[model samples]
Target: MNGILETILVIVGIIWVIVFLLALFLSPKLSATKSKNGGKK
Candidate 1:
């Protein structure tokens, strides 16, 4: 049970890392678009 939980936590951590990296990579483009759109959502 402990090992399973550890594995799940590790997987979740990896996914979070990937998402964070993706956000970092796309943030510039996103900001540019937001600026082009006058920063409105």
Candidate 2:
């Protein structure tokens, strides 16, 4: 049981890191798009 829990925790951590990196990478493009769209969300 403990081993399963540890694996789950590791997977969750990896997913969180990926999400963070994706946001970091996409934020600039998102801002650019917003600007092109006249800053309308």
| Per-candidate local distance difference test | 0.97, 0.98
Q: Which ten residues in a row have the lowest lDDT in candidate 2?
A: 32-41
Q: How many pairs in model 1 have backbone atoms within 3 A of each other, for residues 3 or more apart or on separate chains, i.e. clashes?
A: 0
Candidate 2 lDDT over residue span 3-24, tens digit each: 9999999999999999999999
> What's the CA error at residue 10 for candidate 2, in Å?
0.2
User: At residue 37, what lDDT does model 1 achieve?
Assistant: 90
Position 9, candidate 1: lDDT: 100
Who wins the lDDT comparison? 2
- Model 1 gets an lDDT of 0.97
- Which pairs clash (backbone N, Cα, C closer than 3 Å) in model 2? none
Off by over 4 Å in 2: none
RMSD of 1: 0.9
